[model samples]
Target: MADDLSPEFCAVLRDAFERAGYDADGVLRLLGDSAHAALGRGEPEPARRAARDSGALGSLIRLFLLGDTLPEREVRAILPWPESVSTGVVRVDGDDVRAGLDVRPYGDDQGSWWVFADLDSDLLGGQVPADHVLGVGHASLSLARATIRRPVGSVLDLGTGCGVQALHASRHAQRITATDLSPRALSLARATFSINGLDVETRQGTWFEPMAGRRFDQVVCNPPFVVGPSRVDYTYRDSGLAGDDASALVVAALPEYLARGGVGQLLASWLHLPGRDWDERVTAWLPGGVDAWFVQRDVADPDLYVGTWLRDAGIDPRSPEGSARASAWLDWFAENKVAGVGFGFVTIRRTDSEPRIVCEDLRHAFDDPLGPEAAGWLDRIDWLRAHSSPDALLRAHLRVADSVVLEEVSASGDEGWEAVVRRLHRTDGPGWQHEIDELVRALLAGCSGALPLGDLLELLAAAHGVATDALVVAALPLVDELVRHGMLVPA
Candidate 1:
């Protein structure tokens, strides 16, 4: 484990990093796109080759990122060697210096920062310890991108491994609290905060325990959501709870820690049972008085899921020990009758009115951050709720969202290039697509924000020789759905 450093030392360290240009852009520029991407994929030889002639930045990347040992004199030229050694940032063996922990540059649209975590198992040349503090990885980045980034009074980073989410939250949140089950994780989290000059309260406890009576305006979590047997192999990935219970517990307990109108976002995995609807299984986990959106980004069969996690733990599925572990894991899945594992994002907001819940599979690629879309979705829900009455909905004027594009598909048939399907596609955010019929297409075309929805519906009804009431009845629900997804916006 790494030792803590004083705030002054941390400030000095931050300055050294800044002066050496050891941040994301600096590293990327040093390594170039190909080598940097290769490093991101955990293949460091390309980065090593790229950094050979680079200066202090190269030494920093080699020592910290590639786990290379440098001459003490060389490392001393770049860092405050005495303080870095005393604080466990690096260790000295003879005349060589090596990083004691993993420190890497992480940034977003806001600013640059460094994350502290345990060294990779590959670098350690062994399995990670039980209390391993994970660095910024895919799931953590996904949650950070998906989080609604509006300014808030307070934010809680539950299961804050290495405080990555808290680091992002610090940009917008006035007060931030980060919690984890492992003391080592909390220690590294505190260091991460200190080194970044961020003021965050760090607590060591299980999910929601440290947050007993406190509530936050926003909570972001990337918990131990890997579904598996109730055995603890690693603290960062295993909750020691049977099958997705850890995820369930966190989701169920969120309402208590969330202030009224507060929002919570997390990356989670849920079981796909033989007969149960996957969406329904997740929907049942929602508590009352909260609006939730569950988007399943990927699904893996039992074997694939088990193999992925096993490899993540540094186990070869073909090895004897790995085979035995795989068999036991497979048996557990069979016993539970789990068909597949669904992994996705879950965003829930505490509400005072009738709760609106949406559960669906969104496996498409997105070009925009989900944070803005998430905030907009909640606001659209509120708009729909306020206009629940048919008359109220008809009175409002709406226009097609700027990001929406109408796509028409055609097939070569007997009639030659006949239109088969027409859909409304959102160009950004989640990239939601909705198929539409003639009536719906015409309604959207006429939605120029020049007239109330009711008047537009009546006009369409008159043009189509349909009853005005019937057209209004069919159009209201469709308009509501469109608005809920940001395909349409209030004029």
Candidate 2:
């Protein structure tokens, strides 16, 4: 077990960090534009140079972020050096000192919390160990952004490395369980939870084994979903499963662990086979009676995907070992008939007896804090699925989303200008956009809370010199699509 700092020491550390302004914004201000940008690209030299003349705040950054050695007296003035060393957080080397782990501030608009994990590539100046516990990485941030943050009774954070998700869940969930397969990860997570003054049931197990026969209101995971041919495991990256079975297994097992109306949000990667439909292949893994929304944010071909992950592993693709590994990955994909790999966010809810699936490819930038939008989208999906009949939809009142805007495109023809396309774009999740006809545009623009949708369609038909029934028939599907995708809302 990782040694826990006493409550008194935790308070002292928090006070010192707060006083030194050791936060995201604070670090950015210290490093300035060039160094901050360089640090973001996994190169710490620029930041190190910038921090050479820094004070207490710079000492903390150097020790944690860059793994630089500092004088004993300087370390003592900033923190409880004795306890930190006793706890295996740092080590003394001659007249200088270095941190054994990296702890940094992470948060959103609400507040901030510290996350502890292994030193990254920049600190080590080389490749990471296979079992290294990752800090708040891109996938971790993506999962945090994609989570639904409503009040809930219980939450499960599976594969909770360093307990970042569990810390986020603690904001709303009355009870939280964070499980991990590695004891080292769990130890760091425990210390992290303790330091944050948050209580979570930390269990050591893979996936759902520790939570057998238990159900939760919400479950979040950013699992080892990297598609690789590695027969062995990295614990954090490789699941030791062939292809994307790890992600598929997680999706297939959600129904049994999610309570009625409960949710499972995950960031995963799935293979796109050469001959099969990607949506169909993914949806087929969902258990019955669940409602799902899938947003495919990116797709990478074999060479690009392998190269990207190789770099993530800090392996040089031009090296002999890298060449062998890349060749093996490509060969594996070929044998499996994989065309490409798609990475995205998935939100699943146990809503009804019948399955409902909505899949879309949204490869665009999105708004930050996607949780609220994701929750609203799920509610809208339920509402739209319930009002499937034309008569049901006609009686409901609807309005365009507040964040939506209309865009028009035109082209010059031989003699005159011609309208190429008109689209409705929501300035939220994936910044979803949809094309619409003139009638649909007019109806959406004019909808008010008091008017029935049927009346609006009738008025639109009269204005456009079209039959009312025909207009409604042509527009209903489009309206449903808009509502389901969060472009329109129930007034």
Candidate 3:
């Protein structure tokens, strides 16, 4: 029996899978709409039934997606029996075949790749082992969509469970270094890259432990930032560290490991402790001379937070075991005085000047693959920083962004009508809305990039009987904010 991996083996396997039409689109087509929906809700029976008659495709689905036992003859038809047996991926038991690893197809807009990890909770039907490496999940997808895809010299995927982030980084980065605390996770990640015929350097370490004194042009991580009492069940989600300390450690250590002009994007959860501002608690983690933006997507109270994580670990919330686990989690949170948990994305860019930190709450849904939007934000921040002084800003020619639309709130009054508020709404890309006064709205609407901002402000001041200096002073701050948020542009 052959156990070793080679180019020839991978190519043959790829050809066979292609011939069987085993891919994301293929699986969805075979399963149809209803069964696909059922699988998404963690119910796989419908999918199993749907694919039971699809021939080789059915066998592939049963083996990988459903984790079912199959006849040895059928298994060998898809997988090389000698090599599969030698490698322990599948075993023979009474003329039946069973898998030790779960392999599935995952893809993004760029292309497709096969991902290998421990069987999911639905397939395992129990608590995942402590060292279980997770496959594609909400966290990994969030980080992937949030990662900046700009081509770079090098990138690091910290805590690279099953290496999905690293795999995504491979599309843009010339070189990728992936690290994981669990050796098994690292091995599995290596296998994942090998199967795809992509090269990535895998290191065994926790967080930044393996890359001492090294730096990267870009760093992407989906760390074990879950706020928990302990790391008892799974290493993929829980960090053993006290509430949100793992995220804190990552944030604190980033500046030292990021090259100048480097970018770091991470998905993290932080505790909203009582009597503390969420922004303050999070911004305190950033070191000096790094521009940081923290977009808090959602917040959950302690009870909901604990219960959600418990469910994520495969515990049924309505079951007796779930009740006990939830009680323990809540008790620990109460003892620690955690008021709530905040989940979001943190983007940091290393710069020379003092860090510009902006923490905002955006709870509404937006488009994914936010890398370009994020890169735009950092560029706008740099432009705003250089134009911090009123004189500098007023001398620059500006244009109102096309995506911005002016909207006003009004109410009927004794004076016939009154305007309560004027706001700018962005039509695309995160869709931010901002409130503006009459004067600022007039200035922005009138901007054509032909006249300098100082000249426009002076003309407006003359027409309104206000001092030009005061007008410039009052308008520059709001203009800067609008520019930084991409509502306005420098022509």
Candidate 4:
């Protein structure tokens, strides 16, 4: 494919996209009509990966690869992006309508992509790990940015697809080695490294194979977490396993590579056993000596779970083979004690003691504020575990490693407003709203940098006219926060 846009497609693509109700002008402005022109002709596969991860720009690139008459709707449909319009142009319905900004999207040889990390083109392709089944996307950046607070030394990205996560760590780690089982991916990763001039050690091997005797400071992976049948496809969603046990196997075998104080964070899915708690089932995956933060976001019951993955793999359940495959998935779950299936994020750290493993199922959307709050989450958990209740409080202003910005406003002169924040410990009750009980207590106890956490709780509870028992319960969670922020060091 030519690097320059040809005259033949430049005009036709613009006309067709405009007719299809896309913000043809604005889309072209960012990607450049020339870029669109190149896309209309479609670039070589080698260049497509970069395009796919470019977010909005990828959409325009998508329009080009799909053909001149391709509708803007179709391009967005592939990834289910949200409908958006700018430049006084009419908007058309796309698949999904997510919100954000400064999200530079570009179309390279790989696939549709959105840029979350400030990536240099030289660092792509060859820097990619052999384990990647798909090109890098925004998800890797989202995960990477969300983990700034966690300690990472030698990062081990299991199934390091396109080395997206590994590449992100180049700025954070002393060194990075991205591993993948696919040679093609490794080749591309090498090119990626050379292209971006970013240094990364790329290896060809599955999971921890290439890094046998070595360990990393940080490991970030977005493995094949989908629970699906063993399909021929092994790059993106499909894993080479009977069912989705590949994710479990990866999870079960990952702990050995973690070094002291190192952390491994991955996105995974697991079968939900009927007779067992999902937590217990996941607990089985832990190999001891690691602290884990496991959040199960959604649970798809038997039939639904099986069908979703089947459909996700582009298989139409209406077909006979597809129906049979769905049945097999159900059977697999039932026999394996799986009640359903779940999807979400998992973060683990190699601690000195028997790791404090935490499991939570939060069915919620992960958006902006989510990335910068890693520090708050790390602190929140610490605060919860150390004390029965917490008396410490945080100013709404947040700063997570350098990625978060907390804003606070007060009404005119003597008044102020703050965002009371908390990631629910268990959705036990009222975790989202500020539990002013401790806030009031802490205020009464006086946050003078000297009063013990306990004294604050006792004083505040007395003023709020609340029952002492109830006050005690609330204080415990807050105290846990204090220990987490290092506001109260461990005794």
Candidate 5:
């Protein structure tokens, strides 16, 4: 890529950003909490008012973020890097200076970093170009939060837009390679890595082509998984494949790129067809010898999905062109017998034993930064695999997760008061809630991590006047399900 972005220029840029305190915290401080929240909602007037009197940080925010032009002298005073103008980072028209690209502050719990990408379509007052590289967005952040961020020897960020995923991977991975089909995207990714002072290898190719014969310890992809007609209008969202094929292609090809025991996490979309189970369709995409978890976060009908993506490209749904596009999209959906679209996270880990794949819809809001939960889930899968037999499971001690809470429901009837329902609720990590019967409830109450599960089951069987073998057989599967959902854990 960006051949003009020399190391010296990037180094100078990083230093200038640090000196001016142009970071996540710095930006928040400059624009009070209200104004910052307003800015995130896409209303810039509040931020504009807040920055009118602020100094260099204000000008920096205006130039890079708010898409405002500033006095050339003021920009030069703050940034001594003459290469910015020479390299077309900004255009100088007489006494005015305007940024040519978008540079914003992004960070996690660790520290702050900068992301470089093309200006937003709102700033441009038009649809983005075909090869536009997206900055940090909801999908990218979702994948980042959902990734299992264990320390690894190497990582692969497939279809890295502005290298946001790669940037987060740098915190734990020893080495990383970011790839994309668009050269402009790769160029921006390279610039992002350079400015962050991270040693990431950038390659240009589609999907796995850039990393032929290479296996990575971790692979993270946010592919062009938008489901629609087989037409390519934008590179970031359209895969030019009909009806969710892009997502399926990536999932099918993942096994070849992951090393044994390595993990791959990606964001994907799939279609719901009439009389066909969505989970089964997606589950069939995975090859053998891998444990997978699919969490569907949202579902959109055809009309809503089409309208949302159309407006995302700056097209008004009422416009003639928008109407024509929608008609064609709906026609495609009708021909394909598509019912709806499902979007969510997919985490797969290569394994040596028989694979365990769980697919379910988790639409409830819960705690974010689910990386730790994801890692714990993979470990629990291994533990369950090691103890697949009844005897092995009975010999182990189990405890309810600290975040789990028990709720009992009751109603007054002719017999005064009677229990109606009982449920176990996990307060964190997707907040899964499971209804239980008296037997299961009693069994969970006895799981204080003090005795073996077999002993506890034996005690429950004696109290309930049921056979020990029968209770054990019935409780084993329930315990396995609870462990998988993070409602229970090993002592």
Candidate 6:
């Protein structure tokens, strides 16, 4: 009944569901029965729902999840969600519904790889089961988190499974177009939008097939980057192209659809050839005229890689039925110029200046960092694009903004908080962070602009005297913080 979805209303629903004592499955059943008519097909009731009190909240949650836009006040007053599930960008498209605590059982996260399903979507042209439409993995979220920024005009969420990134992006962009290869997934995305009340443009397509020649101010994806080509491109696994190059192919060709200053972020994996640098392999995926932040998080031994990939498709890693298939995946990697497999995140922005390519491995804990990190990435891309490398002087003086500070509040109020900023490429041209004391001193010392990072470390060692290696290793994160905070710029 409301015009825009509000966080408070969502919270209220979330809180009520917590007290209802219903498991995820139970609540879903109640929702099913209440919202059945809106489901279109024969939507199964998630529960028996022996109730005489199903009212506005129930109706709203169903309507919202099915894809309606409600007013802001309604959403906020419905309270119960924590920060992680709290609102980001998705605004109401139709009526707003509230799914309280019960929403959790319905969603999960995969570190590098796993299965994802949103019952809201329609898979296989609307007939496939919700479980059949797997959502994207953390690898993709990593990249999307790294590159996106605020104030983007319109965005295109490609391959939007349950509208994950699309839902997130709706927070900032005025308009969003979400596309998926499976109508099931699109259906679920629509449902998610409806439930959360986010207005988005949904389409069906393979890659950019549905929106050919269309452009957006920003684009994000979590494609089916899994290696080992599959005959059945179900909700989960697909290397789409050969030798897992499908992900690379998408990357290699992203520029065609990218706006002049638009940014594209994604998670991808690539093969490492016998004599080739993994860095070079991924760099090749980047199209011309784009600045890139590419991170290769982990690599696997061939057999290990094969087994791991197989397990992702809901196949048993140690089962006999999976052995031959897993072996084939390894063989494919070996036969196709692949020495080892590399998995990671990449953020690219179209720029006229010389492209910046940064490759690193960060397996550190990010701690609910999907929002601002991505925005920072876009801002940095703009900085790099505007002022090419061999940056004679990083002449920008800066103030560390409040949002730039991440905190760990202590109940005693006597606790300490760490302030971090990244000065990328400071270590051999990659910026460093002011993460710890040694790196902090090193970075703060560099404010004078005479000593190189290495020299600064040496000076610190001579003065306060810490081990050189210890200092060097720890300096990287600290320097990363500096660069991230705009406190330090490449001179």
lDDT of 6 by residue, 1-491 (tens): 12122434444444454554333344445655454444334343432132223544443344233333345455444444343134322333344433321132233232111112433232211323323555444554565555455778889888887666776676679999999887656755665565555678888877888888887788888877766655444554463466667777778877777888787877787777788787887887776888777767677677887666555555665777677777776667666756777787777778887776777665544444444555565576556445433221133332233233322222333455443433322232112233334346434645555555566666676676678667666654454446554555554
**Candidate that would win on TM-score:** 5
Tens digits of lDDT, candidate 5, 350-399 = 88899999998888788766777779889889999999999999999999
Estimate the TM-score for candidate 1.
Answer: 0.96
Candidate lDDT scores, in order, read 0.89, 0.85, 0.84, 0.51, 0.89, 0.56
Residue 351, candidate 2: C-alpha displacement in angstroms:
1.5
TM-scores, each model vs. reference: 0.96, 0.92, 0.93, 0.60, 0.97, 0.60
lDDT by residue (tens digit), candidate 3, 1-491:
11244446556667777889888888888999999889878788999999897999888988888888999989889886576666556667899887766778888877888876877776678877788889889889988888788899999999998889998998999999999998878877877788888989988987798999999999998998888786546888888997899899998898788999999999988998878999999999988989999989899998788777777778898899999888888888999888889998999999997678999887888774577778999989988888877778888999989888988889999997788989898887778889888788778866889999999998899888899888887888788788877888998
> Candidate 1 on 1-491: residue-level lDDT in tens?
35556778778988999998999889989999999999889899999999896889999999999999999999999998698998888989999999988988998866789888988777877667778888888888888888998999999999998999999998899999999998888888888899898889888888899999999999999999889899998999999999999889888889888999999999999999987898888888888989999989999999999888887777778999789999999999999899999999999999989999998788877778888888998999999999998889999999999989999999999978977899999888889899999899999998989999999988899999999998887777788889989999999
Prediction 4 global C-alpha lDDT = 0.51
Q: Could you tell me how far off, in angstroms, the CA of residue 485 lies in candidate 1 after the best superposition?
A: 1.1
Q: Worst lDDT window (10 residues) for model 6?
A: 107-116
Please give the clash total of every predicted structure, in order.
0, 0, 0, 87, 0, 83
Q: Cα deviation in Å at residue 399, candidate 6?
A: 10
Please say which candidate is ahead in lDDT: 4 or 5: 5
In model 6, the runs with Cα more than 4 Å from the true position are 1-131, 135-144, 147-149, 366-371, 381-491
State in Å the error of residue 336, model 3.
2.1
TM-score of decoy 6: 0.60
Q: Write the per-residue lDDT of candidate 2 for residues 262-357, one digit (tens) a residue.
A: 999998888998678789888988878888888888999988999988887778899998899899989999998889999998999997656678
